[model samples]
Target: MFARIFADRFVLLLLATILLASFIPVRGHAAEVASLISSAAIFLLFFLNGVRLPRHEVVSGVRNWQLQGAIFLFVFGVMSAAGLAMSHILDNILPPILALGLLFTGILPSTVQSAAAYCALARGNVAASVVAAALVNLVGVVLSPLLFALLAHVGEATVSGQAVGRIAIILLLPFALGQMAQRWCKPWVDAHKDLATWMDRISIAIAVYVAFSGAVVAGIWSIVRGDELAWLALAV
Candidate 1:
């Protein structure tokens, strides 16, 4: 039973590692090492994603512009409407910065992994779901800032060309590179699928750790109240 549980939930273990890392107090030089480790882990995740992305699959889906457009429009419309409505309701209650964070969260597109998992569980089209989610995120990399600027009057602070470029560099470039590598690595990826599997598990763990550790080091965790954390957790 224990073995099966671990087999099914390896990602959670990585998350635990990250959380533990975040709590480990470090002095001057040690803190720098910790920060470096966290940054390395985050980059490793993106690198792994790039290495694992299936080029043929992504290329084939590129022709399905109609489906991609539908997904992009749906995500943009729903998130935009939801953000506006939530902002109106919570404008007086939540602090502006927190509120902006919440809005930013909603502005983000649906995560590809979760959306694909849900589609599989529902016996829906997993391929379509994966492609759709990917397209939404890709488009959101640009459209999000534009919508924020237009609807929220979010100036240079909330949405900027630089932000779009940075996001594209960090996220989209990895995905594109992964796709390009997929063809060359197809046979090996098939023969040793465990490599991709491990990369996925490790990447998620690193991400959670880096996020929590960064927050802890910056003292942002202390400023936020327990109730606010609870709310954000629930909101997500």
Candidate 2:
């Protein structure tokens, strides 16, 4: 019963933890270490994800490009537009910092595990969900920063080509390695699939905590409001 309750409220727990962490301060070096650990954890989760997926399903869905592409575009476009609209509106009624909070919320890509789990619950295609969610993150790494530069009037310094290239390396190389590793150890990962699931969930929780902690370090909590969070939830 406890497990079932946690499963149902994982996203809520993540959001709550992120909010709480945003208000707590950490030392500078500890912050950097936490960020590094969080990034590694998320990458490992993604890689293990690559391993645990049925290879045949991923390969077979290569032919279903339309479904994947549609979902990807829809999620990206909708989220971006909603972010811009909300931020602009909030900027008028709220303070600058709170408006900025809305911007960051929109900048993040669609989450993979949540999307996949929700799709399965809704009796939709899990493979399609995985592909679409991954594609969102993969493309968002470039498109998101570019959008900020173009639409939000952010400085080129923040969206530098060098930075983007580094981010691409950080995000892609791990998945590539995981794919290769999974192919080599397919039988073993298949034999112990349950461990991969636990790792994925734990990594997500860690990522949430780390993100909120960074926001706290940056002093975002002081600006955000209950009303804005409610609107963001509805928009999402």
Report the number of the highest-lDDT candidate. Answer: 2
Model 1 CA deviation exceeding 4 Å by range: 1-11, 14-18, 25-56, 110-138, 156-184
- Per residue, candidate 2 scores C-alpha lDDT tens digits across 77-151 of 776677778888767666676676667677677666566545644556655566777667667767777776666
Question: lDDT per model, in order?
Answer: 0.62, 0.66
lDDT of 1 by residue, 108-221 (tens): 786554554445435565445656776676667678877777667767534356755754665456556655776676566668756655554554555455556666777867
Candidate number with greatest TM-score: 2
- The candidate 1 region of ten consecutive residues with least summed lDDT is 41-50
All-Cα superposition RMSD per candidate: 5.2, 4.3
